[model samples]
Target: MAQQGPTAPVPVPKAGSTPPVSKPVREGIDLVVNDKLYRHTGDKTMPLLWYLRDELRLTGAKYGCDQGDCGFCTVLVEGKAVASCTTKMEKLAGKRVTTVEGLADGQGKLHPVQQAWIDEDATMCGYCQPGQLMAAVDLLSRQKNPSDADIDKIGNLCRCGSYGRIRKAIKRAAATMKDAKA
Candidate 1:
């Protein structure tokens, strides 16, 4: 062993002994998705999209640009629209996550936004519709009467270029939701 300097390294903790205090210990994580609790024990850095699609089978959040540029994996994390592709699972521990599948009522009644989509036939390929619906749901929750600028802020890109129909559906859904509320 080398000679110990005046400023030596801290000794390792003995067996069963607690180590020096530092940052919190990393451990298992619990995530709430669509009112369901999921326990994660592997790498905490896994992106939420993989967990939702691969593990939970909630595949509505499509796999698009995985770098957060594409909104195909958009979902609501605590009522805020988030890009699930780049959202780390560690950050979602104990957070409420709502996907497109969870937007409907427990009685199987579709949300007004979903109904609007069907009525307007806004889906073409239907791949990006899930993300669009999620974004629109979040938007409508915040603004009952969303303007064109509000729609633009959703940032969800539809490859089918169905922006016109989507805009119309949003308006229709807003009206229906308002009527239901009253």
Candidate 2:
């Protein structure tokens, strides 16, 4: 038998070599994202975290544990705290979604909760502070007089063990908000 030369393998197309040909499926999701009215097209199953972080570029919500054990994905939805990582965007249709960006004032000033965090030097790694501030704001909005237990129940975690500082900032922010209302 004659010796056969080694044949080269055929090249495979790259995973994303071609632009997506399919039309982007459109579904209407009317919600207020970051204080702006938005109409988004995404599957009802799409997680709220992707809508906020990827679509809107609101990167404040950290990915942490997607299972909701870690409070890093916390955000305010309809003035209540929620775990955005596990929340479905479709469920939030016609609702208000408030991320860290929405907490700022018209002049681009930080919310009292965020300002207090900075003043108290609350964050260490800072990965978890966004959620912490969001949760604190939600708590304060409901319970203007949150006790230690009320604050503790919100489950804001800082791996840096800045819980003490966080509590103090929340108290200061509550007082400030109250004073402003007065």
Candidate 3:
């Protein structure tokens, strides 16, 4: 016969104590993107960038640094610029998300920021323009006449070193929007 060893005692429920009940599992998340409603039932932890690019096929928000440091994945969540790479599906329930594709009007009119970018030749590679445009949209929505410091706070990087042109484009867009309002 083999030698027996001491076994640890198993936890037993006390008298009148009931088993712990598990939390109810979440069914899904619902959100609106580009004015269209979306019901997401997959992993709740999925990043908004992946949902937009992979599931929705809205690839305007580019994947730069997945760490959320670069603003390349920036998008408008409730009209506020957010880093989509770090925003999770679980947090966007019933929220409105807007990608660069949604910036154009139904009549095919380009957004002021987009037109300004073209007019100013603000892009070199054009990889970071989507994020820059979204950020600029949010900024302009808040600040009618943004100064150099305000434009600099857009926080999107252009590897093409088009900062000067980008600043000019934002200024142009701001002016155009102001004119449209008046």
Highest TM-score model number:
3
| Candidate 2 lowest-lDDT run of ten | 4-13
lDDT per residue for candidate 3 within 1-182, as digits (tens), equals: 56323222223334477436387634778677887766687778989998888888889999999987789999999999999999999999978898999999969899999999999999899999999999999999999999989988777888898999999999999999999999
N/CA/C clash count, model 1: 0
In model 3, how large is the Cα lDDT of residue 149?
95
RMSD in Å for model 3: 14.1
lDDT of each: 0.84, 0.81, 0.87
Error of 3 at 117 (Å): 0.6
Question: TM-score for model 1?
Answer: 0.83
Backbone clash numbers for all candidates listed: 0, 0, 0
Rank candidates, TM-score, best first: 3, 1, 2
Candidate 1: residue 47 lDDT (0-100): 94
Superposed by TM-score, candidate 1 places the C-alpha of residue 46 at a distance from the truth, in angstroms, of 0.3
Model 3 alpha-carbon drift over 4 Å, by segment: 1-26
